[model samples]
Target: MHDPLQYEGRKVVVTGTASGMGEATAQILVDLGAQVTALDIKETSVDVETALTIDLRDPASIDASVAQIEGPVDAVFSCAGLPGPPFGELDTMLVNFVGARHFIEALIPQIVEGGSVGCISSAGALGWQEQLPILMELFARETFEDQKAWLEANQETWGWSGYLWSKYAIDAWVGWRGADLIEKGIRLNCINPGPTDTAMMPAFHELAGKEVIDSAIGPIGRYSTAIEQAWPLVMLNSTRMSYVCGEVLWTDGGFIGANSTGKQGGFGEL
Candidate 1:
């Protein structure tokens, strides 16, 4: 029999738990009997064992929050992120990419063998593989201060550049660091969610227009629900996905699959 309380007694850390996907994930973990330490810029109302206010843009805040959590961490859900544009490009990059990497690295010692780290990426990060070289350079930057300077110097003309590039760098970092993690018996993976209706959806529409958001759903025809995105994240964080490492699971309805395969009936298909 499958156990809903399979996670009983496990310890998990989840960021962005104030609302949306992170909130959903933290609640699910708590309900399943795990001790969840939730983090968000604002106070989280979710029913977690611990809630820590963390501004991911500030390394001091990140370190301070981590210092408060007691360990033997079984899983980590890197869900805090910024969508960019009106949200400051440099800050977006710092929060989404650098913050996640730093937190996971900090907790490496606390992660037990067979532990897992699941990152929330986006379908927009699909092109990351080809951009590995440059992304790696930024990922290697020693400090947020250093990266902030580089991000300020190379701001893109488009509004979503920070968001898109941050996700790209995150996806690339997964593959880059996967082997090292796996060697420690800790698996690293990420999920790429398509457009989903959340509080953040309105901001997306404001930045890209409603039509762009609507048309991006691919064959799915509708925005995914928060639970839909959260379930995959939970599975990845659990022992169920022990062998799954260095992978980017596109829970984007069918958007990523369609893009990869191309229009199926377009050329030479009977």
Candidate 2:
């Protein structure tokens, strides 16, 4: 339970911090003495006093907020995410993957050597690596507006699949950064948590119903409390995992071994 990585007075930026893994990660870092700036879409009055309301889907917002941040950073935990449904397919990719990349590109320079950029990717992103070429093609077009235009054009048809593609793209990025991060003496890694109990768990439960949620993940038979995942998350950001880059760590309990499909584990019978 004791985290050896000391964070006293270090600057750390954590996204999706209003709640869940993001919130837990930031709070733990703060307790370890890190000066944490937590970013999220919605606002909350409690928890860490340092917080920023951000919509990663908007390039201007990413630009503006990141621009205001001053000085060298110890780490960047890009944890902002969207599941599906509300944002549909295309929009989900735009925010979770593309927008996350945008924030990284903007802030990477500020992270000093020995710094880290960690993310919360999904275990569902497994075997999705085959689409990396298509994802690179999308990023080649660059510019959030251009990507947005492409999404608007193809969304009516391909949007749903685009979300999956975005996560896949992120999976590829993890490997790409592994080599690149070492060159700069920094590190990059990702965590793919299984079904997690968070602010959004209830929403997922409502949307999919127990038949789906119960069978989809958490091979150990229950969703991981946000805290369960944050420890490893913080460890990855620590020197302990500094040599670990371009790797995807699955902390979803035993879901990857048990749930071949992202569908809740109990659903095959339904």
Candidate 3:
């Protein structure tokens, strides 16, 4: 049988594999015969080629884990993230954007020339374009330390919602950095998933109330499964998607579309 997705025997690295979309993606890759190296703050139950503990908030931890993974990596699925509250705003930004970017940049040399990177952003980043100037400034700080310092100094600007700002950063980054990566024969893309029914749901519900979270759902009128969100991400990074570069695939069940058209209710009105 021919493998349309081309994941068979490929060396793939996935982060946040202990749970949610990351766990689902890792399992799917393993099932497709890819040699998966899973990274998470907690241990993953998935039977992957390698499983390493990593703390995205700490650059040392990220570097050490990346050092352990033998490379020439075919694909990278950046699925790790943190929901705001309970977790501090700074820590959330570090995990979702700063540290995640640092970790991905470090693995560039190991990633094959034609390889791709898929990341998980969120539908919450709906109005990111208006904030591009500030996001571009954030990206200008070339190092993880510098980015962290900038975030620390600018907390008053984005402190209200770390999750939203982090997602916005991811969306802007795919466009800003993806263009350069494509020149090197590497593609970068991300998915803006809507309200998903994962372990992270309770945190969101707690922070914004279930009604607010539900309001984000589109015509689908329901939350998405982890695997449902994972498939688009997997496909985005597939060798077959050679021409798809720096794109933001909305895995958000038409929320973005309907919201834009003013046909959707709830948060769109806000």
Q: What order do candidates take by lDDT, descending? A: 3, 1, 2
| Tens digit per residue, CA lDDT, model 3, 43-142 | 9989998999999999999999999989899999999999999899999999999989999999999999999999999999988999898898899998
lDDT of each: 0.83, 0.76, 0.94
Candidate 1, residues 141-208, lDDT tens digits: the string is 86767766666765653224888888888788888898789999999999999888777888888888
Best by TM-score: 3
| Model 1's TM-score against the true structure | 0.93
Best by lDDT: 3
How high a TM-score does candidate 2 get? 0.88
Model 2: CA > 4 A from native:
1-3, 45-49, 156-158, 161-163, 259-270
For candidate 1, give the lDDT of residue 266. Answer: 18
lDDT of 3 at 125: 91
Once model 2 is optimally superposed onto the true structure by TM-score, how far is the C-alpha of residue 210 displaced, in angstroms? 2.9
Kindly report which residue stretches of model 1 are placed more than 4 angstroms away from their true locations once superposed: 2-5, 156-160, 264-270
- Assess the local accuracy of residue 21 in candidate 1 as a C-alpha lDDT between 0 and 100: 91
